[model samples]
Target: MREFLVEITTTIPEGTEPAEVDRRRAAEAVRAKELAATGNLLRLWRPVGELRSIGVWRAGDEDELHEKVLGTLPLRSWMTLTVTPLESHPNDPGKADAAG
Candidate 1:
């Protein structure tokens, strides 16, 4: 599996119904939980007062990450994602832990 760092920004179109937004948000949360259980989602963080989030995810490759994993999100249409592939570093603390 390859790791990716993703920055996600979500926009709700103007004049959309509040209930619809709420429904989608609920669905998105459920989808996130499912991805986490499958080990696709590693971590997620949001900046204070921002409608954006950053997360770490894993998939076979970029295409699989896009087509199979991220493509399945309920809010995919409303999201703009910047995906960066990660490479292992020799000095990474996680690598050290694993070695020890």
Candidate 2:
């Protein structure tokens, strides 16, 4: 499986009520579980900087990732989305140099 980073950006429309936000949050939790069950969930980080939430996922390909994201309604509606492949990192801490 290939790894991907999925970014989600939420836009709150003018006059969007607090209850609506709460409802969307609840719905996102359900959608998260669905994504996890499909073996696509890796990690999700809520925005702490310029970008929105970052989600690491595993999928057969970009198409499958797009399908999964698009198929979920509230999530699709709330955020602008972007996906990029996670490249292999030779310097990854998990793969230390044997010579060391």
Candidate 3:
């Protein structure tokens, strides 16, 4: 599976009810955990003092990544998202070094 980097920032509209924000946040957390467990989501991180989040995900291609992954987010509508496809590094820590 190819990896993609996804960056998201919430865009909850003005005048939105607090209860709705809470509801979507709860669902978002649950969905994140579910995706992580399934290996669709590889890792997630939030920068200090920032409301944005970045996640690494595995998918066959951009279309599938959107349809099966990003499209399934509970908070998709409230989010401003950026997706970038990733290339695996030969020296990535997760893999052993190749011999000459």
Candidate 4:
């Protein structure tokens, strides 16, 4: 599996209904949990005072990550994402653990 760092910024259109926002947020949480269970989503964080999220995710490839995983989000249409492909490092802690 390959890892990616994804930064997501969400923007609700002007005058969007509050109920709609709530529904999508709820659904997004559910979907995130499901992704984590499947080992696709590794970690997620929201920077203080920001309406955005950053996450580490795993996938077979970039296309699969975007099309299969991220595309499934309830707020996909409302989000702008910057995805960076990650390469494993020899000195990575996870690699050291496995070697030991």
Candidate 5:
């Protein structure tokens, strides 16, 4: 399976309160758990910037990733999504050791 990094950017909806931020976070957690159960989620993190959040996912291809993202309501409402392949690092010492 190939690994992908999904970058999500969201615009806060008008009239949303500060407390709604926490609610949205909770919703995201639920979505992550659901994805994990399906063995699609690899890792996820909320970035410390104006951009929304980042999710690392493993899947067969881009279509699968798209489907996964589409399944999340929060993502659909709040995110502009981009998917990119995570390239394996070459010439890393860890890789050399693992091959030995």
Candidate 6:
């Protein structure tokens, strides 16, 4: 699987009810845990002092990543996402082991 860097910014629609926001938030949390348990989600972090999130994910390809991964997010409609593919650096930890 390929690794990807995902940046997400979320904004509920204007005039969205508070209860709806809470519901979506809860659903999002559940999705996160499911992804993590499946080893598709690597790391997740909420940027300090910012309202955005960053995550590392693994997938067979970009299309699968979009469809099977991002598409499954509960807040997909309300979130703007940027995805970047990742490559292992020569000096990266465990690179030698992987190369061998």
Error of 2 at 69 (Å): 3.7
Off by over 4 Å in 5: 16-25, 92-100
The residue ranges of model 6 lying beyond 4 angstroms of the native Cα positions read 94-100
> What is the per-residue lDDT of model 1 for residues 29-64, given as tens digits with 9 covering 90 to 100?
999999999999999999999989999999999999
Q: In candidate 6, what residue range of length 10 has the lowest lDDT sum?
A: 90-99
List the candidate numbers ranked by TM-score, top first. 1, 4, 6, 3, 2, 5
Each candidate's clash count = 0, 0, 0, 0, 0, 0
Candidate 4, pairs of clashing residues: none
lDDT against the true structure, per candidate, is 0.96, 0.77, 0.89, 0.96, 0.75, 0.94
lDDT of 2 by residue, 1-100 (tens): 8889877787877798999988988988887888788877878898666647888988788887777554564656667888788876877875566447
Q: Write the per-residue lDDT of candidate 3 for residues 1-100, one digit (tens) a residue.
A: 8999999998889999999999999998899898888899999999999999998999899999899988898899888989999997877876654332
**Model 1: which residue pairs collide?**
none
**Model 6 agreement with the true structure over 1-100: per-residue lDDT tens digits:** 9999999999889999999999999999999999999988999999889999999999999999999999999999999999999998867978877779
The ten-residue window of minimal lDDT in model 2 covers 68-77
Off by over 4 Å in 1: none
Candidate 6 at residue 25, lDDT? 93
Backbone clash total for model 4 is 0
TM-score per candidate, in order? 0.95, 0.74, 0.90, 0.93, 0.67, 0.92
Ranking by lDDT: 4, 1, 6, 3, 2, 5
On residues 3-98, what C-alpha lDDT tens digit does candidate 4 reach at each position? 999999999999999999999999999999999999999999999999899999999999999999999999999999999999988778899777
Q: With candidate 2 superimposed using the best TM-score fit, by how many Å does residue 19's alpha carbon deviate from the native?
A: 3.0
lDDT of 5 by residue, 5-84 (tens): 88877787888888887788788779889878877887778877556668788778878677755446564676688888
lDDT at residue 94 of model 5 (Cα atoms): 67
